[model samples]
Target: MTITEPVPTGPATTLPGALSLRAEKQPDETAYVYLRDGEEPDGSLTYRQLEADARSRAAALAAAGLGGGSAVLLYPSGLEFVRALLGCMYARVAGAPVQVPRRATGLARLRRIAEDAGTTTVLTTAEVKHDLEERFGDHPDLAGLTLVDTGALPRAEWTGGFPEPEDIALLQYTSGSTGDPKGVMVTHANFLANVAETEELWPVGPDGVVVSWLPLFHDMGMLFGVLMPLSSGMPAYLMAPDAFVRSPGRWLAAIDRFRGTHAAAPSFAYELCVKAQEEGKVAPGLDLSSWRVAANGAEPVRWRAIRSFAETFAAAGFRPEASCPGYGLAENTLKATGSRLGEEPPVLWVDSVALRADRVELSAPGEGAQPLVGSGVPVLDSVVRIVEPASRTVLAEREVGEIWVSGPCVAAGYHGRPQESEETFRATIAGQEEAGRFLRTGDLGFVHDGELFVTGRLKDVIIRQGRNFYPQDIELSAETSAPGLHPNAAAAFSVDDGERERLVVVVEADGRALRTTPLDELEARIRTAVHEGQRLDVDEVVVVRRGFLPRTTSGKVQRRACRARYLNGELKAAAAAERSAR
Candidate 1:
């Protein structure tokens, strides 16, 4: 079935309106339950309280002379951030929710975003803002921003209400894991349509207990953890993402503790869940029968990860049918496709050799087969087409091509980037004049038997632990790690070493460093700088001699060539790194 715009939900077209209706209809009903560090609830709020808090925050923004514009939201994951988002909806402002950066490079990115969005006002918690200012006061990137604590406002002063359906509600910045981050304009209509369609796949009601530990800044986290509950009239239980990282069992234990019915997470989380079970860290009394929809999306869903999770947790009342693998990007408003509830997640085993030739060949039970989990069909309100990238010709089922999508849930365009918006959001078909709008997702996938199987990205993006890391960014970080490196002679890439994505950085070690510094020490320095700047680990740092990396005629580093060389065991390092070729 082709996707369609949402059928009207009785004045609940916009998020704020839906929330207001819920509060009026069930004022005393619990809307959200938040946990900070333990199993016990840190705080809870009812629909009435949520509405009041949102309105009060909006009123505060209005009093501060901020309206009809966008405001950057800077807060950690918690109820305060949720209210800030809701308050933006009521204030008729688009909230560009950003995480509080902890590093200088991250600060620069936040600065770039603020400058791009042209915002001077920032919404944050009083405590968080005060602490941030104290820590980041000297940094010019944050010095000019006027921080407003929306949570501190009184409910009586709330004046802003529901916004227009077509008004811009949020600017979900693309995850920059593949490239530079750009804001995707998500209108109220887009928000409503996506929420309605997502709920159809993972059906839920007021009694549906939703548990989440995703960071609110990520689109996947924001869409599922913060907005989905309000739109579907479900109660959500939230814990900070860091808490889950420290203890994956906390996330699973939360479901068992709360009898959670629906939950969404990235592939890493499912892997972590499996790791927890293997380590015997999972709660013994955990019962997952109530968790019917354990949806995994945001990153490339691995069949092995889902299969391990389902197999390990089957004894705990978890059903294989509950493992839902899906696909989505920020440009499509979070979820473009997902498995239907009660259906075992779709998977395919393709011959590794044929796949390289852009052909799909089903593999035998035991061979050099690549396992790919199907992201399921396009949402009811969305149209997904596998298209030949160069020709724009729609491909037949099982023919691998770029994934293109169109629907009401599709974003308007990239914010302030008209050319990119037109190219990515309003793509043209090869010959179908009647096709009005389609988004060219830079993802390679195929449709077989009405199921979409994403293979890999068309861009040189390294997706690790569900976060996209651009190769250029990593290369720059590595190049500038020390002055000994040759200019534009570093490459960064990711290769899956069976278990997970391994990041490899190849650099040209300068003659001075080769003579003066220990090679391993230099590699360690590069690792520390990259980790400090990008907030992630590098699997290997290859310090090669001059002219080691492949370069094009324009002196541009051929990252693919470098990746090929490394993968083929042809890359040589000048440093004495006992690195084994993966």
Candidate 2:
């Protein structure tokens, strides 16, 4: 990573305000490059071109009487989606960037976002509009909406003022795989505030190059990947998530080819990249020294896997300190806490027994030590606290509890959800003199040495004999206990038995393993391993074929969904136990 001075805090706190600044400073500079498969970009957008495209679409929306209203913008991964979203901001309209419904994949979520946002207008590209018309022409949810192709609209001579700092910029919809989706109403100021914080910590400037393959509909990818380059005056390279999945090496190759200075993805992606290089799938001699900010966030941070990645890629000029493990959610607009600019990612060795007792115990290298990677402290002006869920009392340092965040980056509230918003976004910590309002993140973690170590989700924590056990730890034990299981292809949860919580483990193995290994023996290994690791009795163990486990769009294992499938006997064919253990 390139060591540099910390970036100054945000001068432009709004997208429109930032756009005007970029246009005035370096209008002809390249802003973004959209790549598909090869080295060269499929399409490119410059500062002037980006501003003009957004202006044309904004003028079209204004002419259509959509000013100061909400609109759903759906488009495939490309530069056109960029134009549509920014155009909404320029038009002073709240744009909801959602995945287009096709063959009933994500249609229901789209409907909910549209209804929740109170928007009837659907903004998409010409090609996607044809697909929606063919697949959802008679659909009731989209029947009354005006479908506009921002790409096809003739260039309008836009002459109106831009959006205000307090104007609505975008509506970020939560992935509702576990439950119903909610639209997070993000203002322009909120989005830019986060960008400023990210810049201050990561320290990227006009000389930097940003690369991303994360989906644009998600917050991590959209705000940091698509919009941050515009605000920071850095050139960016964009690719679809599928593009990277098809060939993980393409992501690293893009970095080497374009001299990428900043990039962010979930931990799973880093695993994929490391695996690709290990398997000789990536071409040799790819230099990653230019990769300054290799951020890992939007999912669980693994200490061993990331350290292994840094060590493995070090032969290719990858620095160990470049990998950053951070934490954030949709409510904060984007980044909240992340790694420092020039420090190695921190990891804590703690006692596992004490972890279950709501305590943080520092342990030496051996003697039942569990290593956890640190999610660095708050950036810029955001504040974080660990609070007891039931009493809402703030927890002391090294005490595990629910995470609460409060800052200007926090959104006003969820769109059209007064009650839910008040409950979640307007939470107050009990017994604190200046508790004030905070956003309950529903995540369980602790502060050690002033850094965050997120343990697990509050709903997914397994309680056995009044002690808390994180399912991810148990799932890791299950995956590593056997040779057949795949990493991240496991989900662990607890079955509520009224008296106490019993552990239930579900893992994925290839067809070869399912056919070769005896199911009884496999289940016993998983049971014994989880029991030994978490000190909890395993009630059930199920091994399904790979791809059977349900996952969120961002690649998180859906424990609640897996529990539903287990209760309904949908996963019986994979691995079924005759007796239930209590």
Candidate 3:
């Protein structure tokens, strides 16, 4: 149950060193392949070519006097992002991979990140730079910044040495689902340690091929799509996020074509693939037997999604045991715990009534039971403790509390926020003062039967009449309540109505469904389902067109943002129904 042994450290300590070693060992071997539109091969790089390109980028950065400072990496998902990231590693410049700004809000976020990192340089492709300049050339926050197109850099040789293990390698910005984004300073050692831990859990042989359509800005994408394969000396197949979004089947087709052994995405993506297959959108006769690890993370792991996907893809030689559920955060790099390879992920059914009281109890298969999927056990030298948030007391097994982790993978702290970092990253457990600082995860989970079972985020829990409720549970009920509701597009939150807290549910519905089904009937179905399922009366139900509800970049419903929009009358509700419930 206790997997605390350290993973073997490789001869290379830093990312640049790892790539250099791989280049020397396998110069002609393909290191990465870019799949344009998730199907056609557009470009590729051998180990030798990749290293040379990275070194040239490093040389350009050094010549620009940008060494030892941070630069925002604003490239789209492709080979350019990978080269720029590795180039920063070689130059000892902290690379902050940020999503390409498409709107005012995204641009504001980019400006905040740039200000926080104390940098005025932006590294991106020439096309993107030209477009940004044409669109937002006179924007106040962007006017003073210098955008350097990496593709246009003059050829030069890198003479700088590799960065030290403790040097900052990346500034992984947290997904601002609930609040402002903060940059987590990930050191070179942190990346190496996380890769080592992942390799120990899911060993990738020389034949391993990683296929990913996840955005490089996200931690899950950077680790699995770039770092893991690079460190394991395996080739990775990359694709843009839009390709998978437009056609979920492309992801599976890529796996089939490339014989990909490892791939990962959020749970909704799995659900989408299932829907696509059911709709006859996926290509027929896919041989997915080669996929060894179908990692599901970056969001809550849904047992329904796992079971549905395994059952749907069973005809394609997809093994049920290949589904790996994991738990992690930006603060801990990528993964803290992962399901063992070649084993079925564990699921536990707990009494719903007891769960509301923060107690775990076995329950039969009925309306009163709620399923909790196991996210596996800790890997490497990582130590996980379930500590009561307010009391700072360590809880026994099966007792739900905030998850605190300490390991080499944990980042140093948030960039330029000393006070907040001290509170979050330097917390001491009660009566275990000398056990080293633990990173407060703000997640609620417990170690039951030697496996971690995450409950919900501490801040997202809704309290109604002194009873605890998780927004995900409420959102799930709303999703299945009616056929018109969009999958994974419900936001449940409580709002104060001059007295106590009242439940409010906001959901997105397809245009066809909206036209066919009566609005009153749809609202009634959602309210009745929640009332019967959770024994909680909904005070208001607002239904909007599809894509109205706000979502984070990783596709998680931003409940707080939805609540704000609802309060400010920004959400144009297609139909709304309210009840005076007390």
Name the best candidate (by lDDT).
Answer: 3
Ranking by TM-score: 3, 2, 1
Q: In order, what lDDT does every prediction score?
A: 0.79, 0.82, 0.88
Q: List, residue by residue over 265-323, the lDDT tens digit for candidate 3.
A: 98889989999999899999999999999999945699999999999999999999999
* Candidate 2, pairs of clashing residues: none
Model 2 C-alpha lDDT per residue in residues 484-552, reported as the tens digit of each score: 676688898877679766678888877667767777888888888887887777888888778878776
Tens digits of lDDT, candidate 1, 1-582: 111233235768788888877887778988888897736798888988887778777776777667788888888878888888888888887888777776665566677777778798878888878887888888888879888777766654564446788899998875443125688999889988888888888889656988998888878788888788887788889988778877989988899988899888866568668867777888796789899888888346767678888898898899999988789888998889988888998778877556655689998645456677888887676999999999999999889889999999899899999999999999978889588789999988899899988876677757765555556546656876875764366889987789888999998875676777677788898898788656779999888876666643223466776787888776753333423311
Model 1 TM: 0.80
Q: Highest TM-score among the candidates is held by which one?
A: 3
Separate clash counts for every candidate: 6, 0, 0
Q: List the residue pairs that clash in candidate 1.
A: 3-380, 3-381, 3-382, 4-381, 177-468, 177-469
Comparing candidate 2 with candidate 3, which one achieves the higher lDDT? Answer: 3
lDDT of model 1 at position 165: 86
Q: Per-prediction TM-score, please?
A: 0.80, 0.92, 0.96
Residue 432's lDDT in candidate 3: 88
Better of 1 and 3 by TM-score: 3
> Which stretches in model 2 have alpha-carbon errors above 4 Å?
1-10, 102-105, 136-146, 176-178, 431-435, 497-500, 515-522, 573-582
**Residue 343 in model 3: lDDT:** 92
